[model samples]
Structures are given as structure tokens and as C-alpha cells.
Target: MAQTSASPDVATRALPATWTTNLHLSSDTGLLQEGLDALEGYRKKDPNKVVVRFRAIGNAPIMRQNFYKITVSNRFQAVIQFLRKELGWKAGEPLYTYINMAFSPAPDDTVSNLFKSFATDGHLIVNYSTTAAWG
Candidate 1:
């Protein structure tokens, strides 16, 4: 059998035994700490209250004032249900809502977390439409 030689670069290169540990420590520790701090703050928020402003889209009817102060512990579903009732929508009728005209959140998501992440100018701008809107 003929012998094969490894490339010079490959032969000279050696893997560090503690590469994983070094990588873990070196990978954006400051950003990681900031993220952890944000998470801690999210988890430790007091009162857990958020203010929301609802805006009608397209042909949707406007609400009176349309601003509400809600508890952060409430799920997104409560907002939907409130809207449906306010608009006198039948149970089977479809309604769509989005945050900051960006995206719709899950019904089970907490209002506090959503407010912390998406609220602007001291209020969460909730856009609603009777037809399908943004994803």
C-alpha cells in the first residue's frame, strides 16, 4: 500500500483541549449579561400593569378613546375577547389584531412581556382589523 502524507497546514494545526470552555467564556459575555439582566427584570416586574391603545385598521370601526390600562398578567386572549364584545362581533366572526402593525401574538402570551418588548411612548399600540392583515 502506498503511504499518504497530510497537508503541511493540517499537520501543524493542533486542536486546543479547552477550546469549548474558551469559546463559551469569550462569546459576547457583555451581551449575554445584558440579556440575562433584561430577563431578570422581565421576571421581577412589580404591579405587572401595562397600558394599551387600540387602533382600527381599514374599514374597522373606531372605538371610544380606544386606550386601556390592563394588568400585565392578562393573556392576549382577554384583549381579543374585549374587542369582540366591544365591536359586537359574533362568536364565529373572525377578527385580527397585531402589535405595532408588525405581528400578531399568541393568545397565551402575557401582556407584561409583550408590553415590555413592544410598547412605545408608554403605550402598546394594538392594531385591529376585521380582515386578515400582517402576519
Candidate 2:
């Protein structure tokens, strides 16, 4: 089959003016600004006063209750230290901690920030195990 070029009249025909006007109006609207404001509100929360809940997993020993609260501003290392002291594990003993049983966070990461990003039902569910659950 031979190729044919479009007629000049058809090629010059423009999109309906209503469609162009609608596109320009939508782009100029402040929807993006509104979305950014909402996101800023969500991320600007106060982590210092947030309380995160810790729960033991597997055969890991429990100190008092099934769950306990810690301030969000505290470093993840504090939780590790507390668990070690509570379990009475030797200095060389190993313990593992994770959030939602998904992944372990860095020791320097702030508890409140983690809680803010991952908490469910207003509680940050932390799982601790004596053996490594994930690499």
C-alpha cells in the first residue's frame, strides 16, 4: 500500500476551544498548592511527644506487659538497650527488633519519626526476637 499525506484542511484543524480552555484552567488552579499544604501538615507533626508501643515476638521474653510505650524522640538504640537489660541478656548476646515484622530500622533513627510514618491504630507495633528474623 502507498502512504498518503493528510489533507491540509484536516491537519490545520485545532482541538475544540473548550478542551483547551479547560486544560489551561485546570493547570492554573491551586490544587497543587492545596495538596502541598496538606502534606506539610502531615509531616510537621510533633514526634517528641508521640508514644510508640513495643511488642515481643517469637520466644523473646517479655518484661511486664504484651506492649509498652516509649517516647518517639528516643533513638532506636535506647529500645535495644532496654530490651537487653530487661531480658538480662549478656553483653555479647544478640537480639533483633523490627517494625511491623517487616524490617529493622537504623539504631540512630528516631522512634517518633518511625511511628509517625508506620504506626497503625495509633500504636507503633514493634516486634523483637532473640534470633534474626530478617537479614
lDDT of each: 0.85, 0.76
- Writing each residue's lDDT as its tens digit, candidate 1 over 1-135 gives 212554655577755667444554657878779889989986764565678999999989999879888888888999899888988889888889999998999999978779989989999999999898996
lDDT of 2 by residue, 1-135 (tens): 112654655577866787465655547448779878889987664545554566777888776754656766688898788777777889878789999989999999988778778988987777888888876
TM-score of 2: 0.59
- Report how far off residue 54 is in candidate 1 (Å): 0.1
Candidate 2 local Cα displacement, residue 127, angstroms: 0.7
Candidate with top lDDT is: 1
How do the predictions measure up, each by TM-score?
Answer: 0.65, 0.59
Q: Evaluate residue 28 in candidate 1 and report its C-alpha lDDT on the 0 to 100 scale.
A: 84
User: What is residue 22's positional error in candidate 2, in angstroms?
Assistant: 37
